[model samples]
Target chain A: SQQGEEDPQALSIQEGENATMNCSYKTSINNLQWYRQNSGRGLVHLILIRSNEREKHSGRLRVTLDTSKKSSSLLITASRAADTASYFCATVGFMDMGRRALTFGSGTRLQVQP
Target chain B: DAGITQSPRHKVTETGTPVTLRCHQTENHRYMYWYRQDPGHGLRLIHYSYGVKDTDKGEVSDGYSVSRSKTEDFLLTLESATSSQTSVYFCATQAGGQGETQYFGPGTRLLVL
Candidate 1:
């Protein structure tokens, strides 16, 4: 079952512009994570924000999590052509019952035009 | 990058046949998970192993089974493959601590006809 739902299923942006993706989950989560997947490739970990943390940053990537709202967002600054890929938000809910499995969203597809 | 690799990156099988996918990790992570991805369903967890010989079912584990005989190897098996099982399968590993980052393998594309 999918716990998170990402908004703006698809987005097109010019190079150097910023891209933001939002994810809303239904249940309480231990933490939220963002992953990037290129065409015909595996997923790469971007950043993780714990329930207690509101914001996290790594290089050009920024992630914000709001436990109260049960939502999270991923923002990429100065997007490049190489940044064109699918972004997915995964939630590790508190009710995993020790399984700690990640439930992923449908994902947001971003296309950065050069 | 984490040293994770999945064997038989691509496989084609017939319905009612049994198939197994292998995931090998050199990092020796304590946790391993198997997930299947389809067009509309981003990714759905099939099974996961917390430690050697310790495994549990996920939300979509009805048609799948998993085994982790060693810390570095986890295998997912479909007892009787079906056309609906055709999809890309991914394996992930996570270290100790809850809600930690998980590293993914390249994935295996399976086709059941």
Candidate 2:
């Protein structure tokens, strides 16, 4: 079962624009991370924000987490054509049994035009 | 890149045959995970290991089994391959610490006919 759900199944934007993707999860999480995947390749970690932190920035990527709403968002500032890829959000949850695993969302496919 | 590599980048196997995919990491990360990607289903975890000999099943672990006999190696085996098992498999490793990031392997495209 996928605990995380990302809004906007697909997004198309022009270069130099900002692309924002949102994700929501069902359970309490220890941390949330965003990843980017190119065609036919594996995922690359973009940024990770802990449950206690509301926002974080890493170079061109910005991530925000809202524990109250069980949601998070990824913002790619000044996007470029090379940023065209599928973005996914993963949530790491801790259940009562102490078991933990990362649950990924359906993902948002972003296309950046030059 | 965390020095992770997956074997048999692409494979086509017949139904009922057993298939195994190998994930190797040189980073010596303590956490390793196996996931499958399919159309409309972003990515689903199959199994993960926190350390050597410590493995656990994920959401889609019915037809798959994983082994982690060594720190650098994690193997995922399909007991009986089926058409539904055709998908791209990815392996990820994470350093054991707070705010650790996961590094992923290229991926293995498997097709079961």
Candidate 3:
């Protein structure tokens, strides 16, 4: 079962603009991570934010996590054509045996047109 | 981009036949995972391993089995392939820490007819 769900199943933007996507999960998570996938290929890890952390930034990417609402959002500033891809949010939950696995959201397909 | 590789990037097999997908990593990551992606289902975990010979099931592990006999290799086996199991499979490795990231492979596309 998928524990996370991302809104705006698809998004289209122009190059040099900003793109934002949102994700929501059901259970308590230790961390939330964002990933990008190009077409039919595999996923690439973008950024990870811990539950205790509210916001983080790397380059033009910004991620905000709200533990109270069980949600997280990713913001891409100054988007480029190369940034066109499918973005997904994965939740890392705590298991009883100190183990953890990622539960991914449905993903948001973003198309950046130049 | 971790040093992870999945074998048989694309495969087409018949139903009731056994199929195995291999995931190899050169990063020596202690944790590895297998996941399947469908059209609208996103990605679901199939199995994962923490160490050699230690494996556990995931949410969609009913028709799949996994083995990790080495630190760099993890194998996912489908006892009997079915149409429902036709999807892209991805392998990932996780860095050990409180809030670490997972690196994914290029993924294997499997089609069961």
Candidate 4:
């Protein structure tokens, strides 16, 4: 079952704009990670924010995690046409019997118009 | 990506037929996972392996079975395929660690008629 829910199932914006997508999960998480998938391709890891971390940045990507709210958001600044893809939020939930696995959310499809 | 590969990138089979999908990784990551993606459902874990011959069931494991006989190969088999089993399957690997990054393979599209 999906543990996270991404807001705005789809988004479209012009190049040079910024795109922000939000994800909310129901259970306590050990960490949250974001991934991007190009059409017909495998997912690529973007960034990971630990439950104790409030924010992290990699290149033009920024991620924020609020454990208190059980939510996370991914921000892409200066979006480009090549950034068009689907974005997913996955959470590593609390361990059960010394094991943990990621629960993915329904992805947010972003379209960057050139 | 990340030295991960899924075989038979695309396959079509009739219902009730047995089908197996293979995931091979060169990195020898200690953790391997199988997931199925369907429209509106995102990705649902089918099974995972923590080591050779150490496997665990995921949320959607009722009709599927997984085998990990070697460090680099994990196989997912559907003993009797159903039309509802059609999906794009992905294999992911994570180095042994907590909250580590997971690398994904190019997914296989399966269509069960």
The best candidate by DockQ is 4
For candidate 4, give the lDDT.
0.93
lDDT of each: 0.92, 0.91, 0.91, 0.93
- Tens digit per residue, CA lDDT, model 1, A53-94: 999999999999999999999999999999999999998888
Tell me the TM-score of chain B in each candidate.
0.96, 0.97, 0.97, 0.97
Would you list the rank order by DockQ, best first? 4, 3, 1, 2
Error of 4 at B112 (Å): 0.5
Q: Write one digit per residue (lDDT tens) for candidate 4, span B21-93.
A: 9999999799999999998888899999999999999999999999999999999999999999999999999
Across A70-110, the per-residue lDDT of candidate 4 in tens digits comes to 99999999999999999999998886324557899999999
- Candidate 2 local lDDT, B11-93, one digit each (tens): 99999999999999999888898999987788888999999999998889999999999999999999999999999999999
The sequence of per-residue lDDT tens digits that candidate 3 reaches over residues A1-114 is 788899889999999999999999998888888999998788998998988999999999999999999999999999999999999999888652255788999999999999
Query: Which ranges of candidate 3 are over 4 A from the true structure?
Result: none
| Backbone clash pairs in model 2 (N, Cα, C under 3 Å; residues 3+ apart or in different chains), count | 0
Off by over 4 Å in 4: none
Clashing pairs in 1: none
Top lDDT model: 4
lDDT of model 4 at position B16: 99
Q: Which docking category, incorrect, acceptable, medium or high, applies to candidate 2?
A: medium
Candidate 2 vs candidate 4, TM-score winner: 4
DockQ computed for model 3 against the true two-chain complex using alpha carbons? 0.81
Candidate 2: misplaced stretches above 4 Å? A96-100
